[model samples]
Target chain A: EDQVTQSPEALRLQEGESSSLNCSYTVSGLRGLFWYRQDPGKGPEFLFTLYSAGEEKEKERLKATLTKKESFLHITAPKPEDSATYLCAVQAGGSGTYKYIFGTGTRLKVLA
Target chain B: NAGVTQTPKFRILKIGQSMTLQCTQDMNHNYMYWYRQDPGMGLKLIYYSVGAGITDKGEVPNGYNVSRSTTEDFPLRLELAAPSQTSVYFCASRRGGTTDTQYFGPGTRLTVL
Candidate 1:
């Protein structure tokens, strides 16, 4: 069975605070890992995709890194606008399919 | 490119009633998917299609049906609505190949009574 778990279900940070969200998974095989940001009453917005271990991708103040068993989304000097639910998902190998197994997500609130 | 679009942003369905949620993307994406999210829970895959005329069940496909008659549109059908089916539905599409990013629609909020 495949499973994804995210840590720190909720986080509150000061405007300039920096932190990282973790996504650990157990899959038969790993194809890709994705990071997304979702606001209340809206759909998720794609952020980054990391394919292999030791790979990292970044966008603005957000950075995503992946290892064999886990992935991390690091936010540097976050702002109030960066407050949203961060989602982690994985695409496992086999079947050439893109069915994603998603984590429960970490809700982040940045106080200005 | 309008990315992905979903219609009827909100709906209220009575038990046993049926409804179809429409999703369309203009990016010429070859893969499309339907997902449902409940409060405080992660998104669950309902159905997906690799291309036109090809569809398959996902993790939570029990009360749902999907059709991918064209590369641009994928609609999810709820045959018999139930309270458990009340959720926020999202539509996403991805380009061909393995590394393309998946774009998502704004989502539809459904309430079943």
Candidate 2:
């Protein structure tokens, strides 16, 4: 079976605070790992896609890094606008379809 | 491109009623997917299609049916709505072959009574 777990279900940070969200997974085979940001009453927005271990991708103040068993999304000097639900997903080697197994998500709130 | 779009942004249905949530993409992606988001549980895949005329179930497909008749549209059908079925449905699509980015629609908020 495949499973994904995210730590620190809820986080509150000061405007200049820096922290990282964790996504741990156990999959049969890993094809790709994805990071997304979702706001209330809206759909998720794609952020990064890391394919292999030791791979990292960044966008603005957000950075994503992936290892064999887990992935981390690091936010540097976050702002109030960066407050949203951060989602983590993994695509496992499937028969044919690319079904993503998602984590419960980490709710981030940055106070200005 | 408009990315992915879903119709009936919000809906309310009585038990046993049926509804179809429409999703379309202008990106010409070959893959489409349907998922439901619940409070605190994250997102669960309902169904997916690799291309036109091919559809398959995901982890939670018991009360859902999907059809991909064209490369641009994939709609999810709820044959019998129930209170437990109340959720926010999302549709996503992406380019085929090694494409990891799946663009999502705004989502449909469904309330079953």
Candidate 3:
């Protein structure tokens, strides 16, 4: 079975504090890993996509790194505006289908 | 371009009532999907279509139906609404497969009574 597990269900950080969220997965072949940020009462916004192990991508204050078995979303000096639920998803190859298995997500709060 | 638009931002439905949630994208994406998000739960796929005339069930397909008669429109139908169906529904589109970044709508908040 292919599944994703995210840790630290919730986190609170002071403004300017940096942190990292973990997303681990168990799958046969990883085609891609996706990161999304979702605000309250809104749909998720696409963040980054890591295609292979040791791959990394960054946007503004967010950086995403991927490995064979796990992925990390590192927030650098986060601001209150960056507070939101972060979602991680994985797509496995050879499924002969197009579907993504998503993690439960980590709720992040940046207190000002 | 109205990337992906969903109708009825909020809706309240009584048990056993049926409704259709409309979704349309102007990006000419070949893939469209419907997902329901429960509190604290990740978005679960309800249905997806690769292109016109091709629809398939996803992770949670029961109580839902969909049609893709054109590249720009994909609507999700709920027959016999239930309290268990109360959730925020999101419609998304991508140029292709899961590897592609999906653009999502604002989402529709549905409450079942």
Candidate 4:
């Protein structure tokens, strides 16, 4: 079965603190891994997509790196505005279908 | 361009009542989807459309129906509201591609009583 698991269900970080969130998955074949940031009362906003192992993407204070069995979202010196739930999703290959298996998400709070 | 938009930002429905959640995207995406998010749970796909006039069920499609009459519009219909169905419904779209990122709307908060 294809499934996604995000660790550190909730995290509280002081402003300027750096931390990493984990997303582990078991899929038949890895197609794509996605990261999203969702704020309260709003839909998720796309953050990054990792297509293959050893791939990495970054945006401002956020960086995402992918591995064979997991992915990591590293926040560098996060600010209060960076506080939000981070979601991880994986699209499996060999299914011939369009479906993304998602994790429960990691709630992050960057307190000022 | 308005990436994606959903009507009725919030709603309250009685048990057995019916309502349609409207979703529209001006990005001319050929693929659209509907999903529901609950507390402490991942987003569950309810329905999706590959193109106009084509629709398919997702992981949690029960009690929900969707129609894609045009490429820009896809509406989700709830036949009979249930307390379990109360959730934040989100609409998303993406251009034709296996690895494209999906853009999401603001989402609709539906409450069942």
Candidate 5:
């Protein structure tokens, strides 16, 4: 069975603090790994998509790195505006079928 | 672009009631999906459509049904709403191919009593 797990169910960091969230997965083949940020009362917003191991992508204060078995989302100098739930999902399928397995997500709060 | 949009941002239903959650996208995405998110849990797929006239069941579909009559509209129907069905529903759309970014709507918070 394919599985995706994220560590540290919740985290609190001081403003300007930097931290990283982990998303580990086990699947037969990894077509892609997705990262999303969701704010309260809103749907998740797309962050990045890593297609293969050793690939990394960054946007503003967020950076995402992917490996064969795990992925990491690093937040640099996080502010209160960056506080939200970070979700990870894996796309594993073939022959045109899509199976998106999502992690429980990590709720982060950056205090000012 | 309107991206993906879902109607009834918040709803309350009594047991045994039925309702339809409307989802529409304007990005010409060939793929549309319905998911339910519980508190502290990840989003669970309810149904998905690859294109018009093609719909399939997903991870959690016991109480949900969907129809995709066009590329822009994919609605999910809940029969006999139950307390366990209370959740925040999200509708998303993705472009063709296997690995495209999915754009989601604001989501609808449903509560069943």
Candidate 6:
């Protein structure tokens, strides 16, 4: 079965603190891994997509790195505005359909 | 561009009732999808459409139906609302490609009694 798991269900950090959220997966064949940020009562916003092991992508203060079995979303000196639920999803290669397996997500709160 | 947009930002439906959640995208995307998010849970795929006249099921498709009669719109239909169906529904779209990032709408919060 294909599954995605995200650790540290919830995290509270002081402003300017740095931390990393983890997303691990077990699938038949890895096609793509995606990261999204969702705010309260709003839809998710796309953040990054990691296609292969050793692949990394960055934007502003966020960086995402991928491995064979997992992915990491590293926040660099995060600010309060960076607080949001970070979601991880994986697309399996053999699934004919473009379905994605998603992790429950990591809720991040940065207190100023 | 309006990106992806869903109507009825919030709605309440009694048991056994039915409703349709409307979604439209102006980006001329070739793919559209519907998902439901429960409290503290990741979004579950309900249905998806690759293009007009083409629709398919996703991880969670029970109690829901979708149709794609045009490239710009994809709507989700709930035939009989149930308490278990109460959730935040999101609609997303992307240009047809494996690596294309999905663009999501403002989501609709639905509650069932």
Measured against the native two-chain assembly using Cα atoms, what DockQ does each of the candidate structures obtain, in the order listed? 0.80, 0.81, 0.71, 0.82, 0.86, 0.75
State every prediction's TM-score relative to the real structure.
0.97, 0.97, 0.97, 0.98, 0.98, 0.97
Model 6 clash pairs are none
TM-score of 3: 0.97
Give the winner by DockQ. Answer: 5
Q: For candidate 2, lDDT tens digit of each residue in A14-56?
A: 9999999999999988999999999999999999999999999
lDDT of 5 by residue, B11-50 (tens): 9999999999999999999999999999878999999999
In terms of lDDT, model 2 sits at 0.93
Model 2 ranges with Cα > 4 A deviation: none
The lDDT values for all models are: 0.93, 0.93, 0.92, 0.95, 0.94, 0.93
Evaluate chain B of model 1: give its TM-score. Answer: 0.97
**TM-score of predicted model 4?**
0.98
Off by over 4 Å in 1: none
Task: Encode model 5's per-residue lDDT on A1-112: one tens digit a residue.
Answer: 9999998899999999999999999987789999999999999999999999999999999999999999999999999999999999999877686878999999999999
Pairs of colliding residues, candidate 2: none
A40-88 per-residue lDDT for model 4 (tens digits)? 9999999999999999999999999999999999999999999999999
- For model 1, residues A22-91, the per-residue Cα lDDT tens digits are 9999987788899999999999998999999999998899999999999999999999999999999998
* Alpha-carbon deviation at A74 in model 2, angstroms: 0.8
TM-score: model 5 vs. ground truth: 0.98
Q: How big is the positional error of residue A88 in model 6, measured in Å on the Cα after superposition?
A: 0.7
Locate the minimum summed-lDDT window of 10 residues in model 3 chain A: A91-100
CAPRI quality of model 2: high
lDDT of 3 by residue, B14-101 (tens): 9999999999999999989999999878889999998999999998999999999999999999999999999999999999854788
lDDT of 6 by residue, A4-100 (tens): 9999999999999999999999987888899999999999999999999999999999999999999999999999999899999998865445777
- lDDT of each residue in B1-112, candidate 4, tens digit only: 9789999999999999999999999999999999999999989999999999999999999999999999999999999899999999999999868677889999999999
Query: What are the per-model numbers of colliding residue pairs?
Result: 0, 0, 0, 0, 0, 0
